[model samples]
Target: MAKMTLESLRKLRVEQKEAIERRDTGDKSIHIIVGMGTCGIAAGAKEALNVFLGEAYTRKMTNVVVKQTGCMGLCHAEPTVEVKMDGMPDTLYGKVDADVAKKIVEQHLLGGKLVNEHVFDYPARDIHKE
Candidate 1:
């Protein structure tokens, strides 16, 4: 292995700090959670997730936090997305394609309006207890 140089170490430290900053937290005024479980991936969630990240970056949306989570337990509704904004109800959207994801960012994130057609009710599961 090549020995690390002083300049290389400094670059690595900057990258590490940026990665930690990318970790989304609830404290943000607006946050998005993309389901990335096996079922979600098979249904094209990876693209949806990327869309969220890319759009946010393209728009320079600093106040929004984007994160990924495993199996929302709505397998039939694969590619689920959850949006949480301050002073608003937590909204869960199902069957989200890349287009829908973009719409969510525009209508929901930017406009503060939930896409009701994509929103559905899912029974809460106690997966943790299992």
Candidate 2:
């Protein structure tokens, strides 16, 4: 066993504190959920998921989090992706492929525009509010 040193203890404490702080204040502003159920995977959800992850990394997008979920009960619309972002309606996009994933990241995430053609569901609101 290695003997404890004061310098080592202090360094460990600092590293732990920084890790805790990062976890506590993650504050990701955008959440992208890809359906990974059997139906989704068969419809190419894996590729879409990879594209999303790759785009986020290649583009250095810090405020976004991409994750996977089980079936959303929209099996007919496999490869669905639900995106939740501040100041925008939570949107579920259907038939998401690699191309659509790129569009979502570029046009929706970056340009703040919905890919209306692929949108399957979203919160209903009065048009007058817009």
Candidate 3:
């Protein structure tokens, strides 16, 4: 390795900061949470996660955050993904493969439309009030 220069150090710092900011969710409103538990992983959640992250980066989605969590207790629906966005009902999608992940990014995140078929859960509305 060559000697480190002051200018080169500063450039490196800037580049590292930008990369960190991309993964930060401080200002992001939309959150895509992928289940990464044993069952989910067995069902290919890792591939689904990669698709979501890649799609977000490729589409220049600055307001979206992709993250991972443990099992959501939907073992029957392994490889689940939950999407929460402002102005839209929080939705959970099941059996998310690579194709389903892309569809979630394109149809739900970009077009602001829910991908109805894969939706496993959604906020239930109250029907009666006292």
Question: Mind giving the per-residue lDDT tens digits that candidate 2 earns over 22-98?
Answer: 76736657999999999999999999999999998777565678999887777788799999998788889999999
**Per-model C-alpha RMSD:** 5.8, 8.4, 6.8
Q: How many clashes does each candidate structure show, in the order listed?
A: 0, 0, 0
Model 2, clash count?
Answer: 0
lDDT of every predicted structure (CA atoms): 0.84, 0.85, 0.84
lDDT tens digits by residue: candidate 3, 2-111? 99999999998798669769778466479999989899999999999999888887765767778998878777887999999987888989999999999998898878
lDDT of 2: 0.85
Question: In angstroms, how far off is 63's CA in candidate 2?
Answer: 1.5
Best-to-worst order by lDDT is 2, 3, 1
Best by lDDT: 2
Give the per-residue Cα lDDT of candidate 3 at 41. 97
TM-score: which is higher, 1 or 3?
1
Off by over 4 Å in 2: 1-28, 122-130
